[model samples]
Target: MNSDYRKPLPGASMQGEPVDFFDARQAVEDISPGAYAKLPYTSRVLAEQLVRRCEPKLLRDALTQLIERRRDLDFPWYPARVVCHDILGQTALVDLAGLRDAIAERGGDPARVNPVVPTQLIVDHSLAVEHNGDDANAFEKNREVEERRNDDRFHFINWTKLAFKNVDVIPPGNGIMHQINLEKMSPVVQCRRLDSGAKVAFPDTCVGTDSHTPMVDALGVISIGVGGLEAESVMLGRASMMRLPDIVGVELSGRLAPGVTGTDMVLAITEFLRRERVVGAYLEFFGEGADALGIGDRATISNMTPEYGASAAMFYIDDQTIEYLKLTGRDDEQVALVETYARHTGLWADDLDTAEYERVLRFDLSSVTRTLAGPSNPHAHLPTSELARRGIAVDYPRAQQDEQAGR
Candidate 1:
């Protein structure tokens, strides 16, 4: 950690007082004048982690990449936590159990082995709908069926909760992992106390097992999806190595039409971004249209990150983010911390006015109509107005008459 960059955050009352945070903006500006003010929101959060956790000796070069928009060198990213569904989570745990046994055989203390980072495994994917929704007892029936079908797997998952440290499991029927993460798990900003008794705050970031994990990016947390092996590495406290991604700015303008839904806007965006070739880019969405949206609408867009082929879909921290945190029932003190830290550290939306991006794309919300995706591909933007011309919306009676006439 770079103690030189560690500074106290004002107006943040964690335990009746303020807490410390890594001064990432200062660090960036020291290298290049006015560079921090131009960094995208994603880069700012990444820089904070590097400032707080990256070795002091390597800090300057890492911040240089973010400031200068270079990606030639690899830097370290230590995700704050890992989230997973039952299947991949089980696989990673099984691998760890095997490792423990191997260690025991080599005269090592297997009990000492545990996940270094916090992990949450939700048992969401294994349920089979044995009864349809029309049945009032459908949920109960399906849950029963799932319990019976996966008894052994459930037993192992239960045992892991106790046998392993830093492992928490959410049993089946609660909700989908991505939805639960957005509504419940992620705290836009997280706090941890150092051994010296000083508390420090940083953005809540995570890696999840499913692709839809980016759904929580709606909350301004830099959550991303990774495969099981990548998740395991993070779980074991190993840094995910990476060069800076292509951080693209998506400036939204205009208001959505009255009848248009968030789904409509996202479908359109998916197609536009795909066509624009944003694959593997980290996207930061800002502007009047983005500000007009609630978190639910933002989540709708972020949930389809893979459809647009972007690594992440991010929104800036602003009043909308604060409101959503309150709506989701986050702690008042934590909420205050989020606002205070962001404003003080140049993470607020207002602070981003001068921010620059390597590439910028403009999207108009009003331009989006009642839209839909392809019959096959998610990015195949299919507006409802085009359905008939595209031969998708057939006249039922005409089709039947044609069939009768063997046309």
Candidate 2:
């Protein structure tokens, strides 16, 4: 905290103490002159997190490795929080309780075992798709079935709310976790008070128990979906170790063809990227095409990151993200904070136009047409007009005739 970059924030917390932060922009400039500006937004964010969170002695080595793109060295990533849907989220909670019980049996302190970091458990997966559509009593009926079937899981979840120190649960019948995160939970930039009595501001990042957790990444938050085990590990204060992922720039140009929804664009892009074998890379969307896309459109692509085998699909912090924050009813002060932080930290969209990548993929949005993904695989984009050619249409009369003749 003795560096030139460590600056105090302009507020007093509930404890009335001045908050401070390690200025990531300054750290990048000090460690490697002019390099921060060259990093893609994702790299810039990762650098900032490492600067603020890593030990000072080890900081130089990690910073150097990141700037030089040394994939061999792994660094620590401490997420701001964890998000979980009931399916895997419940499993993780049950595992934690089991861990506590095992510790107690061994005479270790059971109460000491709690999720150190904030954990949000949304009961989004409880309803069966069995009762979907048009029925006025559908939700009521599904709730009954969900409660009856998942009574034991629900009991554990309720206990976790009271038993764990930093656990919050959203009862069933709420929307999906990813949707909730996009609309409300993720702040893009988080300002919080530390136990050390200093409040700090940093980019909002998280790991979810489902693969589509990266949906919030469309808003320039770094969220990844992880397994329940990994979520538990992070929950217990373990740093998630990761090699710097390959940051691939995807340059988009041309407006979407008329009638081509964001879904069509994503399906086309998914198919293209999948064939290009973009596994393990962070896909950064940019160019005029990217700027033209709405946050809703961007979220569509980010949500499909896992299907294409990418680690994260990210959109740079731009006016679009700020507009989205406003439209979602975020407080004016928070929106101001997001813009100020992003602009100053070299994470904004305009700051990235000159950023270079080791590899680049070009896609023209005009090439996309209105299309639907598969009846099964999401990447299988079959145009409605081509369905007959693909033999997806059944000869209903022929089938009925065959059935009547007992053939």
Candidate 3:
């Protein structure tokens, strides 16, 4: 055991002490360090497990599986649950409906092709924020427009609501999916009965079709946003396999200035991290700065993991994670169990040591400025000072030219 190994956390004992925790790289060896350099946060977690769990000789073979053929690997991904907002959920169901048609044409039973996993779809994304700032009828008017514009989509979704099994649909006019997940959907700790009827507690983990799925990571659940293609495979019970990634430890220091919203900080970090090119790497944020951020703020940052092109932006189980579980309406007993399990199992932030990483990055929060990202891509940041340079200000001459052209 390394002398640096921290003691096991309080309830994390189900897996044993800190010393017994798996070494990320001990299971796999001798790959070009450069290749690991660019793997994203989500890829990093997948790699770590593949290295630590698979047979030693097959480690390299397994690592190369995704890289060599781009074929889906056979691994176990027990997602806590599946989440979707209406647009993508509807589209995914449409694909399934179309697949059903294809399968039926091929002389297979379409009814047998239902999702094997529990799926939740919310109808929220289509609501345009056309009306703003607490208008009494804004929601109603928005709903009306939403219904008109999305008639075809809704017709299909309504059909799915009745036709699909192992699926639940949250009708329109609810809050955003991420917010709802934070407020209602995600269960910080999940319970399952074993074959012998003994209940077991494990860390909650899931994959959402939307990129913002990582928002739940702030609650210490290992949730990630995946593309529709990859999600389809997982939906059908396929393991997303790959080599271990370079775990990048990002140490955030300092505090945001007053009046700076979490949004501002995230936009700034997105710009900085993108410049550093931590693409396709698993990022673990730690230090005094992380402690300073509220769970909501952390969720905001984690939600944008895809925007930065990384896989999982993870914050380890810590006081923040515990507090979030409480704030989000998780049962007190379950929240306590999460704290207990994480501490005992060495999954807590403080217990991570031999947990090796290929690289580390430092960020100073005090330096972040009030900002927004837009016009084209989220990474194309336009600091307020550079707005004129980016042609954001209206040009009266050009407007006049366009007005005359219209006439």
Q: Who wins the lDDT comparison?
A: 1
**Candidate 1 Cα errors over 4 Å, as ranges:** 388-407
Clashes of 1: 0
Q: Alpha-carbon error at 254 in model 3, in Å?
A: 1.8
* Cα lDDT computed for each candidate against the true fold: 0.90, 0.85, 0.68
Q: Estimated TM-score per prediction?
A: 0.94, 0.89, 0.72
Score residue 391 of candidate 3 by CA lDDT.
82
Better of 1 and 3 by lDDT: 1
**Model 3's lDDT to the true fold?**
0.68
lDDT (Cα, tens digit) per residue for candidate 1, span 114-161: 999999999999988879989999999999999999999999999899
Candidates ranked, most accurate by lDDT first: 1, 2, 3
Using TM-score, give the best candidate's number: 1
Residues 1-407, model 3: lDDT tens digits: 11112122334323232212333333223464434434433443455445434555565666664233233545434465678877667767878889999999999999887776667888888877777668988878888898999898888888887888878888888777888877777766555444543345445677787878888777766777777766666566555654344457888999998977787788889888899998887788878898788888888888889888887788767887787778777777767677766665456666653354557888999987767676568766666656556787656687789899995
lDDT value, candidate 2, whole model: 0.85
Q: Each candidate: RMSD to true structure?
A: 3.2, 4.9, 8.8
Q: Ten consecutive residues with minimal summed lDDT in candidate 3?
A: 1-10
Minimum summed lDDT over a 10-residue window in model 1 is located at 373-382
